[model samples]
Target: MTKKLTGVFLVLLGLFATGTAAVAAPPPSGSTDPVGNDVSWPQCGKTLPVSPAFAIVGVTGGLANNTNPCLAEQLAWAGKSSTGGTSQPRVAVYVNTANPGHSGSWWPSSNTYANVTVSNPYGTCGSGGGGAGPVDLPCSYIYGYAKAYDDATIRGVTNPGTYFWWLDVETGNSWQAGTQDATALNRATLEGMATYFKGITAGKKGPDGKPAGVGIYSTGSQWGTIAGTVPPGSPLAGLPSWLAGAKTLRGAKSNCSLPGLTSGSSVAVTQYVAAGLDYDYACR
Candidate 1:
């Protein structure tokens, strides 16, 4: 969480959906939008933002399918978040994401999860052929789904569906390297997590009268390399974006004008680092 990872976009063999310029309209002049902070296991035993306007807590211990040691205590701290921002939520959680294929200890080998069979869009998961091993789309989807499910059901996060969820996609995590196929598999993994998050929040409205929100957190270039351009029909389409890579609050605010990770999504928050802590600026 201290060092930023850089990633480059891979050239796709086939054309993928391209995102439009999704900019965030700045808050009114002199508007006192609540500035919030995000924390995880890295912040354990450290001082946190004093009464942050809102708080985003990490659910993992810096890897997919892992737990944050301070989750319960952080959630309690997050519970103290104040409501003064526009698009930001009072309490939200993020999960680390990766697509390690079969190399991962918990890589998915089947389409059925928790006894329910999933209809994968990339055909059969274990059916695809990988240069090194089996890194098919279906398996990637299952891997993402299982991780998010574990985070929600067993990661000590109480009532996960009640809070907004952000998928932390960074180059620091284990991802398939090389060609477009890797990008597709990585994208599928994220889409799977989105499906599960959206499913759990279905029919349940939040303070904004919308289903618990699910969004992506990454830099534009990192997202391009990991997921390429998400298809408009894909589950990732239209989700909000939380852009990272700003040095100051002013820089973070300016990032709100940048394009979102997807064509249909809008930038909702821009993050900046100060004193080793990640601070977020509500864009809308």
Candidate 2:
């Protein structure tokens, strides 16, 4: 990856840090919190046109847009009105671990509006490398976002609609779905996170008053390969999918490319620009 793309990824993960003193907390209940990070690939910078047609918020350059600013900007775009559609934009927040969860305010006073979204934290790559176990890190781990979200932060939230995404940029370069064709340790870690999400928001509510889905972020070939092959009765079978890729989303053979393949209510948020910004869209 080019230096520019690498930097953009760093900034995107950095958005998760909330306060000065980072702390040690439980991993968000999405993945197993296994000892690794999610994977984020570099793009050629040719992103798709900004659209009001999708939901999930894909953070890009902190363009300092008034209509949107940081997390709020992403939410604003997701909730904006399309030219002629009634689709309500859905905003997503990366559970950033760079900064601590919050201090005085329940939500981090990033000076950004509590857009009801945040991303998971970790260094540029996602895993902190402290690697205590499947997923454990020091309080100061740069990309170790687990510390940012714990019992303390959520209990303090006046608005729990701000869904927390346990995003990791660390999927092995290959899919571990079908055969026992590889690292059981890594796969277990990833599965452990999926188990976590089932309970993360066991007591939370959505912006529209519904249970939110624990997100799984990965590239199509990586996540889809495993998720695609899991049997209907598998524990990880019901998880939601967040496929990362810019160009594929712009085209028709997007996440929904395969027939009869239910990504368990999936969304494809691809990097449209080299600015580390991405946006997801609908198949139909």
Candidate 3:
């Protein structure tokens, strides 16, 4: 095999080995402290050897650049499976409000509003590759609506109010820096998304009989770099947090004790990377 193909094979093999080893024994019992896993297009068509206590399937393939090819199948699996005697499953979407490439880019200010013409100097956005032009809604609204639309249209999620939604933010994706204004814009983008979801699920209640809440899936450092310190009394501060960047189950469990980026919000989940697989520890 070519070097590139060899590298890819090794990575996959490593992931498989790690996933298998990690679940060699059944997870701990209890509905309150459930164990779960999250996946994207990469794991499509493969059945997990061990059934997760819960699952968080991905909707966007990468930074909203495109929809996941296996989104339908993943959603179906989540919907069909029951965890802790609950039918509802968790779902997550990629968020990159300031990436400078692709139609999903949210930088340059013009792309912040719904229904407006924006100039893309970085050769991102649209088929022709960036320039002055009218685009769809802002990145936040577009991402929020795209996620809700995909869940409803493709996954048959008629009432999204029933499931928990997570926004995946990571340093692996693009971000803004060098200026305070850039940070503010990023915060606005995130808040816009939360606002949209809140509006849609206003009167709707989840299977738990509570309005579904939006949560941030990120590490404190990553969040600080992208959006800066979450302002006091900010709406984002009230949303739940899903901590990431742990390397082991022990580390992940420890992360659960860390304070959330939002002042009022607490860490609801902690993610650990094992054998290249993303596993979650839900905080009871």
Best by lDDT: 1
lDDT of 1 by residue, 1-284 (tens): 43352222211211132211112223323336568878776666666666567778888877786677777877877775445455677878888889987667766556777887877777665534433325778778887888888989998977777878999999888898897588888999999999999998776655545358699999998899899989999999999999999988889999999989997999998898876678788898
Measured against the true structure, the TM-scores of the candidates, in listed sequence, are: 0.85, 0.44, 0.69
For each candidate in the order shown, give its overall lDDT on alpha carbons. Answer: 0.76, 0.33, 0.55
TM-score of 2: 0.44
| Cα lDDT of model 3 by residue, 137-255, tens digit | 34432433434344434543445655566776665555445654656656655665566566556666655353465778877887888778777755577788888877778788899
How far off is residue 267 in model 3, in Å? 0.4
Error of 1 at 262 (Å): 0.6
- List ranges where model 3 is wrong by over 4 Å: 1-33, 85-158, 208-211
Residue pairs in clash, model 1: 19-263
User: Candidate 2 deviates by what RMSD?
Assistant: 14.2
User: What stretches of model 2 exceed 4 Å from their correct place?
Assistant: 1-89, 95-182, 203-205, 209-211, 224-235, 246-254, 259-277
Off by over 4 Å in 1: 1-33, 81-83, 127-133, 207-211
